[model samples]
Target: MMRPRRLPPCLAAAILTATAVAVLLLSASSPGGALLASRQSPPPPARPEWGPGRPPSFAYWISGTRNDSRRALRLLRAVYHPRNRYLLHLDAAADAAEREAMAEAVRGEPAWREFRNVDVVGEAYAVDRTGSSALAAALHGAAVLLKVGAHWDWLVTLSAADYPLVTQDDLLYAFSSVPRDLNFIDHTSDLGWKEHERFEKLIVDPSLYMDRNTEPFPGTGTRPMPDAFKIFTGSPWVILSRNFTEHCVYGLDNLPRKLLMYFANTAYSVEAYFQTLICNSSDFRNTTVNGDLRYFVWDDPPGLDPLVLNESHFQNMVNSSTAFARRFEEDAPVLKKIDDELLNGSSVQLVPGIWCSNLSKEQGRMDVESCLKWGDINTVRPGHSGEKLWRYISTISQTRGCS
Candidate 1:
């Protein structure tokens, strides 16, 4: 092989300086990296436009498993917005090819590429929704979102079975007037049957320690209910505030950690982890809104999951006034109905918003283009759905208090 040529002393110095600056910028861009750099460097500049009177952005963690990539993509498109950030995760149950395909799909969208607001979890972990591994996966997602350093006010978690009932514009407009610190979580202090089935019995999730997906098995011993903190349970889906998420992820208090340990051996910890944390904490208890902002219909004697939404549920779903509804079958007709009536677009097309209108006008096209014109992302225009949501929230807030 031929010897490589050496650069001149001046050129080498310039190259080194450029590389150092690039490294600094990369480190400062991430939330976790910025926290480390703060001890040594000046603080990063703030985005004043994202302050008060602006439409707040949401960081969505949309997760799925094997054969759910297409459904996840549909959900992402339904909820997609230039202002919001999205993280799509495929658990270890999905093969590497599936994960790669999901990433490619996200990158294939011109608007997604333009905004650079979507990401895929490259490293997959086994997740059993019936066990604590699901809770771990959710916490991991929240941590990644925080590290990504997005300027978002809330963190919403969704699954492939979920679909948006309202457009992004409608959701943003309805939330604009809401308090930034409030967390929309459905919870009740009464454990009822879950007290014995979920909390008292001990179980071990193989997903936590195994390389392959496995079901949770019961352990020999049982544990008593803790008198130290009260337990609350509710829907696994949640819309959490930034402050509350930070508290769970990085709070100095020991309550979050203690609960994490307690729930590690519990079944379906996702339903109880955040609920117990918020209800037990003095600081965040007052911020609970007692609603998850999601619509779900369970059977008379509810089974493990909610009934899969179909066309028959369309009218009731529309009247629910919730931003999202869950447990939709793949390519269900109800999703198409919601897309046509509420979202103003097809399932494959993004829900049209002010940004789409701006892009259409700027490009001088009669219809919106696939490529977006990023307008004032901080602004929002509410529609009839927004009015309905505002009314629903107002009515609930007046009567519901944190238990």
Candidate 2:
């Protein structure tokens, strides 16, 4: 989001980090994790009871590079919910101390500690957005989420620059009714210009091999598009179903691995790999929803990146009613505005929701860092934004394109 723009694919991590995170799983070893790995519905994490139509929980893979720990933490707090699971990561460019600091901040929260739904990747390797390593990093994050906590329904990827436009409750409430098998990925069979620049561009991501001093753009070469399968490209950001992520990771079918090998040499593979895989796979093609549910303000000519949002974009952003927006400046006034105007909470404090019920009830509650007490996490009290988001998702879910 800052420099070396993040290739946002809602779920992912690094192989190097996988070796080190062997012991940091937030939830204890349980059969639920195994069930999730086997692509079945795992028992929900031990939390409060609820009535019918309980909202779906998300597994967020929030990644950042060097010097982004605070920003990542800020984003985590903004989206935190007892219902969801979080895996925070500072990539290889970031040092051990920064990773430790990020972990410490996550531990600083009482609700997170009580629920044990958050974790920080202790080890990392290079991740270059312009190369296939970006895709690798995302895959790694998905691997970790699948490994550690398997209770979440959907996998959401967030960069430090991204902030939620809708509160966690709103997003969850909206998604509560959607079919679990449906995947929300913006896609098009029309490659147009990307067919040459993206699919045909053969490149080597140095980060895949090295540990530091990542070269921004990898060297490139030209090759014809793959004849084996049709290629699809669209917004890198996606809200992937757990089954889809498992399909990507477990590789029960050879298509995922075949595409992985093919895209490993292609530049910005994160933008196309998932799209191509889902669209090509017979089982998942019809489940595609043709929208990523992210709000962005594009440049006049629409350059490689979206325009950096600021105060001027607030009303328009709210009008869009998307779940998240990207590329905000660190601690920008607009963030404060979103916290106050939209979220109905403080920028520094967790978004007020049913889960944080006891925080408001307690007398002289001094700890601002943690929600000392909690309420029924399964109970969802959706705000107006939540209702609008539900409608937005319902309308978009009817669109077609993955085939």
* Highest TM-score model number: 2
> Can you write out model 1's per-residue Cα lDDT over 148-170, one digit (the tens) per residue?
64588999999999998888888
State each model's CA lDDT, in order. 0.76, 0.76
Clashing pairs in 1: none
Superposition error at 36 for model 1 (Å): 39
Off by over 4 Å in 2: 1-52, 216-221, 358-369
TM-score of 2: 0.87
lDDT of 2 by residue, 168-259 (tens): 88998899888888898988889898888777767767777787636545445688778889999888888999988888777577788788
Clashing pairs in 2: 10-157, 12-138, 12-141, 12-142, 13-137, 13-140, 13-141
Deviation from truth (RMSD, Å), model 2: 7.7
